[model samples]
Target chain A: MGATEMREPSFLILTALAGGPLHGYAVIAEVAQMSQGRVRLRAGTLYAALERLAAEGLVASSGEQVVDGRLRRYFRLTDEGEQALTLEARRLRENADRAVARLRTARSRVAPA
Target chain B: MTAGPEAAYRRLLRAYPASWRRRHADAVLGTLLDQADAEGRSAVSVADVRDILGHGLLARLHLLLDVVPGRVRAVAGTAALGSGAGLCLALLLLGEWLPPWAPPSTREAGFGPFLTVGPLLYAAWLLAVAASLLRHPRLARSLLGAATLAAVVLPHVVANAYPYAGVERPSSTALAPLAVLGLLVLAAPPSRPSPAVVAATAIGTVAAVGGPMLPLWLSGGSPFPVRDFFYYAYAHHLAVSAAVLLAAGLLAAVAALVARRPAYAGGALLALLPWAVLLLAVWRRISTQGMSALEPLVVVAGVGAALAVLGGLRALGVRVRL
Candidate 1:
């Protein structure tokens, strides 16, 4: 229940790429949209996270493309990235389950018997 | 219309080092342009600019360390070995052939209570330096810290650690240089200094510093310290240590230039500093009323400062093939 090392933006980016490869802007927009646009991303922040993730072998550049008369470098999750995402998801689920079970126990204790 | 997003983002990317830019520019610029296009950004935002600028400069600093072998540990480790050798030599000089130079009521003192504590400190300190050279940073740091504490504090614990009669217990202050050296090693990040670099720094300092000691020893006896011009033999030896220290340090710097190892040069400066302090203490032993204390300290300090700057200049991007 403790894989909190990955920041929310990084987790979102990795999750966005899990569906397949996406270019830089697509990943940014997808992350923002996934978080209901509450997590807007700047280009610089995205690159920094991408570089860190790439260095950690969690994400990598799949290839490049020329999109709408501009360069688009696509990124995808690696096997390691998928494993990390899986672990984080599991941890999050475990934590949520524990919280829900504890709340249900407390509510039942206070309910009429 | 103002400069497009491409131009603005390209400008921000310039904060990174030339090497990083050369490798990542096109790809990174591509991403920036794509982001700007998709976001419908007419201009760069403050947060975007800040992020790029910060990371760019951070990359530059990392590249600088990568390019230069002159990491802070280079100086500290080299200083550790060099000073260790120099200290041994100075101790030998003091231990032998200089007892007559000792004043009354003190010549009979055999390091007083220091003998018990000094050996352990030396052994541990030597091991720390070895650990540093062996690339065991954690062990080296722990040992160095322990040695520093022992050097700085243990002398005071053992009463009359100095050969001087109770009239003079300079052991605590005397070991200050060793403590400083230890602290330097402990404080710095362990850089990758090849064994060759370490050996060269240690051996070169010894050979250079030892050359003068032979003649002085062979001459049969050390001359008394002179406060006046040309009358004192001790004064010449005093200058001898500092001069050779400077020469050895600069020579090491030059050798590092040849080898493209900036760390060796920095180590030389570190080695020079403690020896300078030891030399001052040696001077104080024989220094008479005629000599101004400030005079020799200034001279020694000037030499030390110059050599230190020479070593540190590598970090300033002076480009000693780093």
Candidate 2:
């Protein structure tokens, strides 16, 4: 609730909207592409996550348009969303650095030293 | 135009809460259609439907958690206390009703160990409940955790030497320890139970204890004057039924009081589960004994119909503010 940590889908959703405002389908497509098709955002999950993000002030509705007889609402990441994403990225980076450093030390010790 | 993938996707979107659907249903349906078109598919996939339903329900639960955290915790505590007490009492009554020749010593001896461990475990449980009532959340959680662990472990130690060796233990008897554990886990949240929850739990425990004692009191130390009385009169069957019906009535009242609140609605349903288990046991006994189950069956049908009607009305956009 306090942006302690973002789940993978939420992280990707925020990342998807980082570049510019995108409609629902565009955000889904962008997230799938960002995750290299490993994470497919279903309509329900995407919308639910979007709703939560909006409630948390992490996302905001930019506008809406009628595309092919359907309503397409556009959303963009808010300043809070950007800050949260940056914090999460830094946390992940720090964790990864620690793990990699440990592995390097282990390898060096085992390499005929 | 024929109802196609779009229609199917729209139907799936209905699984979301009404407020959620009102805001995002069309948007989600549009996205689903776009995804289907991108995949060159004509119908919604099973995975899509599963995702919709699973996420929708999770979102609803999250909303409930957000709205009524305290009420939810109180309901959980009440459920744990009520069910755990009911199951322990049932086991004690069952031991009492076992025949003289059927390894009675094991049960009698079992009580010695039970008296030793039971009081300690019960004291811990009481302290936990009291702490919860007094708003001492940390104390309540710690005591509940210890009491739950002791309860789960003590049963095995107390009944180690075949209390039911010569007799076929009713499978339902095995649910007691599990119920105790579940009750503790659910009720151990760091929140004070409301006055209504406390009152309901006390009433529920009293009803549970009194239900089994009613038939004994009625029989007045003499065997019940009816055929298959052991099955119906002295076997705790009537007691369990009475207990279940009483608990169900209480839960129904709570559910009605908090009809508009999703958290209480879900919690009330969860608290009614012990009653459901007891009802099933009674139904099984009634069927096995070939007794007139018409009355009980009618009660079950009536409750089911009422729930179904409520659900249907809710689905029809009726604001269930009862």
The superposed Cα distance between candidate 1 and the true structure at residue B49, in angstroms, equals: 1.5
Model 1 chain A: weakest 10-residue lDDT segment is A1-10
Candidates' C-alpha lDDT: 0.62, 0.61
Clashing pairs in 2: none
- Fnat, model by model in order, equals 0.54, 0.76
Best by lDDT: 1
Point out where model 2 deviates above 4 Å. A1-4, B1-3, B56-104, B107-320
TM-score of chain B of each: 0.52, 0.47
List, residue by residue over A13-76, the lDDT tens digit for candidate 1. Answer: 9999999999877888899889998998776678778988998899998888775556678899
**What is candidate 2's lDDT per residue for B176-291, written digit by digit as tens?**
43343345345436364555655565556556544655555345333322112223533345435444554564556456545766545545544554454444455555556575
Model 2's CAPRI class is acceptable
Give the clashing pairs for model 1. none
Interface Cα RMSD of candidate 1: 5.1
